[model samples]
Target: MPKISPKLAICIVYVAAMMMDGLDATIVGPALLAIGGALGVSPAATNMVEVSFLVSFALVIPAAGWLADRFGTRRVFLGALAVFTLASGLCGAATTAGGLVAARVLQGLAGGMLAPVGMAMLFRSFPPEERLGVSRFLMLPTTLAPALGPILGGFLTDHLSWRWVFWINLPLGLATVLFGLLALPEHVEEDAGRFDLRGFALATPGLGLLMFALGEGAARGWGDPLVLGAGLLGACLLALLIPAELRSPAPMLDLRLLADAPFRSAALVAVLASGGLLGMLYVFPLMYQDALGATALDAGLTVFPESLGLMLATAAIGWSFPRLGARRVMALGLLGAAAAFVLMSRVAPGTSPWAVRALLLAVGFFLGHAVLAVQTVVFDTIADEAMGRASSLLSVLRQIGGAAGVAASAAVLAASGGAGLGAYQAALLASVAFLGGALLFALQIRPAPAPQLRAEAEPSV
Candidate 1:
């Protein structure tokens, strides 16, 4: 057997952990009805399973960086992976809705740590310019897993049991944990400082409540008192959190990173672009199944082309980034993605599935270009010592963006009366508007210097 380099081993471990995380996040969707049925819960009550995960996931994200820095990346990541696997077992074995929700909370807490810490490890393993080479590792975990989730979930629910959805994570998660233990290197930042209790106290509940409000508002009406109360309270806390974090000697989120132009631009572009893409994912299935009367399987299959396009585009990015520079690539990508959304906005109930598939392919291809560029450039200037906090902050922002996207899309659909081709079309156009905003930011990105690009292109000694 060929010896695995440390970098290759790190990539494998990160990809495995993230793939499981992504799969777990979306896999529960298709099994919700079955899960609710088995647990003897009302459909409305069943939503708690997902909401619990989202809130807990939001709550733990701000703490991930500190834990990784204070302890060690390998330890935190492997521990999280092990806990996530154990939680998956608990979820599968649950006899009641409350039990299931509790297990999911554990799952979310652990799941939240996997991404940022693993991301930090992955990026730290490669130089800034050479980071593009790891794009393939990213594609499976980020794009393919989410795209495959509904399909896999639906299949498991139909053929076997809803419990299988969570159970499936067991082998995958356990294998990852074992491999990670053997292969992953440990790193701790000496300057990580004491825990940012003040920042954590303020940011944690604030983000949790905000995520709760966003998730509930999309499901329940925005006018619901719970939604209103949570949203207002969350917003107020977060408002106070900003200044508090800035003044703190060791902030949990490190908002000061935004002062760096490349990081700021990349972060903003990530939020907008991911919001649009995720919003489209949320809306497209509903449009297909409800408005167009397609089956769940058909909807999932139609959406699969997007992942295919993303994989192809990501494979090409390793070649493209050194030649075009990040700025031009991002701009062109945003432009193309916006155009694809514009085309998709015109999709009607009468439209052919193949036509929709082709458009989604374009959307995914363009988004691959934009997202990979953002990822490659985000940490270019960030010191290794700060990579943990930077990754945490970016993860939090992207999560918020994703929730906002789903909420905004839901709001648009609700405004248009929720059950027509026109409503879905309007919702999609909302995503296009987001892509346009991302384009504006993408244009602002300053490309790396020519010398750096040349260095990135040359073969390593």
Candidate 2:
């Protein structure tokens, strides 16, 4: 029997964590109505459940690097999973919306560490030469979670209860934690600097408030004082955070990494590209259920095939990047994603199931390819010592981008008039616009010198 390589084993643990995180993020969309009914809250009120989680999640992410360095990656990771598991239990047991929201806050705090720390561990384990293969391991959870979330949520809600959605995380979280304890090797940094309290003070609320403002704007009018005020305040704080971190000797996050051209371009591209993908994820489920009159399970299944395409596209990147070059490969992906969005915009209520599936599948494939391409660039340029900081920044950017996407789509859908083919079309057009922006950024990526590619291109495991 072939032995499991340690790199693969560590990746498996990260996949498990990512899958759990992804499921929780998307599952709430499907289970929202049921949760509202159970807690005797209005639909608008229940949105706070997701908002609470996102806010807390964004707030704690900046601290992930500090915690991982000060403690140990393994210890921080396992502790996070434990806290997340316990919070999931609390979320499941809650009888009120307020209780559930509070529990979600705790879950988010724990979750903030999972992706960044886990990713740092992966980078630390795999040498730069082998890092291209890392995308495949990531694809499993990254593709599966959003793919499985709605289907699982719908089934559990239809057959069991919405509470089971939160309950479901308990077993997976616990098992992954247990496995991590045995499998993960400790790699504590010797001189992890002092935690930057002032930077933390600025960043945490700054990000949280920004995320909160986006979430609020999705539900409340953008002009509402609270939304406007939160947006202004958050922006001001983040504006302040930059200089504070750059000047600080012990910054909570390593803002200096942005100085690297490759990392900066890749990060910006990720933020732009993710907006389109997240918009589609939010819009498609609603379009199927509301526009096409499909049932929850049916709508979910309609979207499931996209994951297959995503996995295929991610797998192809390992082979393609060496020959095509990252710039060209990513350019093709962005163009293809833009085309998919255009096709999706033309979809109507009466569009055939097969046609819709084909469009979404194309979307998933293009986006998967595009995202992985940028991610490869990010790791390629980021230094070994700053891996943890880079990972956390990437994760934070992704969450912020997703929230922005959902908000933009929601706003367009509302403004264009709700729950109809026109609204869906308008929302999809917004996605196309976002992808077009990403394509421009993709075009800006200069070709890496030949030596760089040859040095990084090791055989996939």
**What does candidate 2's lDDT look like per residue over 221-242, in tens digits?**
6798998998899899999999
**Clashing residue pairs, candidate 1?**
none
Of candidate 2, the 10-residue stretch with the lowest lDDT total is 452-461
Candidate 1 lDDT by residue in tens digits, 143-207:
56766887887678767888999999999888888887777788998877688788878877787
What are the root-mean-square deviations of the candidates from the true structure over C-alphas? 5.2, 4.6
Q: TM-scores for all candidates?
A: 0.79, 0.82
Which stretches of candidate 2 lie above 4 Å from their native place? 1-18, 32-55, 72-75, 93-100, 118-147, 175-190, 379-388, 449-461
Q: Worst ten-residue run, lDDT, model 1?
A: 452-461
The prediction achieving the highest lDDT against the true structure is 1
Residue 293 lDDT in model 2? 71
